[model samples]
Target: MAASIGSLLAEISGVEDPIEELQSLKTALLSIPVSALRDSVSGQRFDVIFSLLDSNEREQVELCVDILERILMALSPVNVVQNYRVELQGGLTHPKETVKILALMQIGRVVEHPDAVTEILNNHDILRGVIHCIGEEMSVAKQAVQSLSKLSHSKPGLDKLFQSDLLNAIKDVMATSDIIRYRIYELLVEISSVSPISLGYCANSSLISQLLSELTGDDILIRATAIEMVTALAHSPHGRQHLSQQGIMDKLSNMIRGAETDPLSSLYLPGLVKFFGNLAIMESPQQVCETYPAFLDKVFEMALDPDPAMIGVALDTLGLLGSTVEGKQILQKTGKKFKAVLLRMSKHGSLGATNLRVRSLDAISQLLTLLPEQQTEDLLALTESWFQLLSNEPMDMIRNIITQPFPELHCSALRIFTAIADQPWGQKLMMSTPGFMEFILDRSTGQTKEAKDGKFQLVGTLAGSSTAAEILGSQHYLRMKTYLREGPYHVTAVATVSTEGAD
Candidate 1:
């Protein structure tokens, strides 16, 4: 096997058609298992492969780099990579652009292995060489960015890149060509995601303005990338504060409002919505409501969007806005239409659409709490529509909402239930639902202390209503009474409450 492999390598090095010979060599090398390759040869195969990296022929160099990349990726021995590290690094600055690109590609594969990452990090010049290629031909520049992205995956590799002058090189290349701007933006975003503080250097007024300008560019892809970069920056408080000082909120609000009037502008609506959502975290609900009134209205409109993802995000944004006193007031002013939209969205059937449903219910729950005494009639009217809309699969939907694995959604469902319990008509409607009593009894029997307590409170609330009291006293309440007596002590205490004394 060793003699045959050596024969193949000799043909690859000396053959007239290098590509054909290299392909044959790659096939033969791949046929040998890594263990066999390691045991059979005294590093001669790797030396033969490494010798090609210095060849005058670009095709031979690229083919060798490609083959080496495969070998490195296949869990080859550390010495296999370590022996050629210097040669690979040298190829980064080779006169031929093709060789440099292939070398960078091979280096990317190398760094993907944990063993090679430490070796590569020790050589800062190799990373600097890759960054220097960012200003080369477009294809080469893209390969450089791809390599940098791979290197950025490791904290040490990423730290080396940040400590270097790569950002300045990125800025220079970004200014010269919109062609490579998206790739550069991607690298920046990747770095920011891993080390947000490293991106502080680019958080100045100039870079922010550049990104904001891209937000309004005619190209949708550019706008999308800019949105991603801004989102990454917003991950850090410093980045968020920097963007806020540059009026990011106002710009995002303008983009959102513009999306309302122009369908083309609406292309940025989802990105703008996400960006606005992140920015909202740095702000109080009152500040958000005051800063972006038009944007907030647009968010409510998106809550009913046909796309589940859009509806999910819009619902979350609304929930944030309704998180405060002033924000809740603003949502309430949208009136019954807003409540109706939320109720309709709460019944979405798609799997993983629970968050959207949960957020919609949460927003409605907030509105319920904010409603004044004078709005009791409106509350009853809204609850009637909720029950009617959910009437078809009422039991299934209620079970899903209350039993959701996430505590937030679970609690949000209970909040909606509690809000309904406050309304006289709602209590009667809830008591009459087919699964309503079973749900309460099942919950009362739950092992979790919190669930049992919540169920107890809900049941106690229903027992206060005369209509519910009549229903509870009937034979239908026998199951609950049996569970209370034989079930957990908490359930027994809740069931023993007198209807007259409950309210």
Candidate 2:
């Protein structure tokens, strides 16, 4: 098998149509043991393959690289690195752009192997060769960036990457085309994630100024990528401090505010919102609100966007913003309108809509705990409508909403039920709906402790009312009593009260 596979590989270089032969060779080679193939004829085949890298025919070079990539993937990385180090390093500097890219891609695969990583990183010439290819065609530059990203996985490799003239090379490529500029930003972001100090190096005022300038650029992708890079930087304290010092918050605010009028702003509004959220992570919410007074309003507008994904992101940001006192105050200023929008979204049945709906309820639940009762009264008033919707909803739909995979939605739904139990009108409406209590009881059976406690509270609240009590009657009341007694301390207290009343 090994000799036959080697024969097929030998035919690849001499075939009239090399691609078909290469495919056949690749399929045949994959079946044989790598050790067997290596022992039998891989050395001679490797020589034949390496010679083709010098060929003028692009197809032949491409096929050779493809075949080499598969062969390298199958063999031991250590052996391949040791045996073919010189040839692989030479391919990195190969004059043909395609050869350079395929070679870098093969190197990327090798870098994934722990043994080859150190070997590749130790070769400074090969490292420099990979970086030099960044100035090549856009496709080649992307491949080079990916290779560097892989190399940066290790501390030593990352250190080597920074010690080189990578930053200067990036700046040089930034002048060439937007595509390469984007790849550079992407590579920097990837490196920063592994070694946050990489962000510190790129956090210079000049580069940040350039990124901030692109935030409002006419090209949508450029603006989005700039926002992405900025967000990535905001992950670390050093990056956040530098970005804040450079006034990124103000630029983000301006873009968000301008999104109301500029049609183009829509393209990058979600990204700008994300950047603002990242900034919020490191900056105080009060500080964030102070910098951008329209922050909540802009985000609330985005929550109401037609795009469900945008709505989900907006809701997530609102959850973050509502965590701080200053943010809650800003949210309260538009509390009624915001709550109304959320309540409307909560009833949407689409999967994306349901997710945002769940998130919106959680956000609203948090806001209710912080805002003044009177300030939240209008928001709370919406609970009757929510109950009305639940009462009228199909049994299966209600079951689905309460038992969906996301426990947050289940918990949020129970919280809404608790809210309904707080109101006289809501209680009256809920008791009037047949199977409502049973549905709550069914939902209560297998919930988390927190959810069970919430259900127990709602049951106790409803059981306290004479009108609801008459509807629950002796049998249902006994069942509620048993459920409560089996619950935690607070629930047992409620259960004790009912049993004493029965006596």
Candidate 3:
């Protein structure tokens, strides 16, 4: 059967085969096992299939299309892709667009097989067809890109894929159409996520410039996708440099301004903010500080908006921005105006001096930390008035500070409290804060153990403690027991630090 098919291919190449011969060859190609199709003797047989698949003759082309469909449905079995190179090119350029599309689709479906991927890389014209389909129509183009993702899967192969100029083709598709751009952006992200080094190739291409242009696009989804891709690019040291060179800061700042209240804008804001925050290199900390006040204004505006979650996010970012050195320098330049706004905000009841107020308070705390010691004095004085508010705040509120999105704040605040407890003057300020000590005591309770001798083996990791055995020493246990019975707060919440948690 294979020999007959080979004969038919040679005969058909003459353009003089009887129609019946073409028909029989098509049936045989359809019946041949994909594994057998990879056999040495099957080369000529595949050539025949490719010939008919590429034929300009109407019936021959249709038959070839159906056979290609069958082979693809068979999972392009056995990777019989090598010897069919010329034939594959023929299908890629078939006169009918639908046939050309199907050929590319078939190639994509099987392209996961190493040999088939190699075949794709080897035939530049066929690879071009795949990219063309990606640029031609949204659905078809997306499908074409989906195939490119497979070629970029394995580590070495991703490097090879880039070497083949396929990565550049993907970048070209992104440059051409929104749908193509969307698919290509996501695929590049997946590839980069797997092998960050591949991003260098993407960076060298026009990917950053094109994506930056899309930042200003009217389509929110397009803009969001572009930002996501930018986030991936900014994740790597190499990619971040490319982004800086692309003038991403100015463009992103503009996005923050225009989209502040658009409702759809914040969808991309956190990630964009995080990415900008994470970039290892920036044009200048001063330049960033110059632009950041505009961002802070938007953030403060969002905080005052009706949305509670948005308010929290805004407060959090304000806190993040304020914690930075440049942000502090910027805050310093603003001087008394900044201090005044903070004082006024502290007195404002909308933040309510409640747990819901923690986000705001935490932001204030970060701002205070960012200030110089002398500069923080005024804020510390303001805190004396809100001291009762903190004193009355729920254990859950304190627990949340230690437990929530930024556990570092909770830890920092607690450590400060611990330090204050150790000072004569500071201890007076915190003397009435019974729950705070009990909170630390609860966290330390896990260290206690019952010895085989029926006594306690106390284990502890207290800061500045000389030894674990010294913790809850006989005298201390009595003190702890008395404190537990008459404790200001009877219950405490212990937090586990996971990556999703404190860590």
TM per candidate comes to 0.55, 0.61, 0.47
Q: lDDT: which is higher, 1 or 3?
A: 1
Q: Give Cα distance to truth, residue 468, candidate 1, Å.
A: 19
The Cα error of candidate 2 at residue 375, in Å, is 21
As a TM-score, model 3 comes out at 0.47
Best by TM-score: 2
RMSD of 1: 12.1
- lDDT tens digits by residue: candidate 2, 45-129: 4776787677777777777776776677666777777778788788877878767776787778778789778888777777777
Estimate the Cα RMSD of every predicted model relative to the unseen true structure.
12.1, 10.8, 13.7
Which ranges of candidate 1 are over 4 A from the true structure? 1-42, 45-66, 74-102, 109-129, 132-143, 149-168, 204-209, 216-221, 257-263, 278-291, 304-337, 343-503
List runs of model 2 lying over 4 Å from the truth.
Answer: 1-24, 33-45, 53-66, 85-101, 109-125, 132-142, 153-160, 165-167, 204-209, 216-221, 254-264, 278-292, 303-316, 319-334, 343-503
Tens digit of lDDT per residue, candidate 3, span 414-497? Answer: 433332232222334333445543455543422222111111111111222232114324454454454445433334567986
Best-performing candidate as measured by lDDT: 2
- Itemize residue pairs with steric clashes in candidate 1: none
Model 3 clash pairs are 134-141
State the C-alpha lDDT per candidate. 0.65, 0.66, 0.54
Global local distance difference test of model 2: 0.66
Candidate 1 lDDT over 1-503, as tens digits, reads 76876787787667666688788777776888876656545556466677667768777877787676665545453554477677767777777777677677777776777876777777767777777777677778878878787777766765566555655655766777776666666666655555445455334314546766787688876786688778877777766766678777678777776675676654567778777666665566556657677766777678767777677778767666654455555655667766666566555521355566566776656544423353455545654554556436544565576775665566666666665664666656666677676676664344566666666666555544445546455654555555545634443334554677666
> Any idea what lDDT model 3 has?
0.54
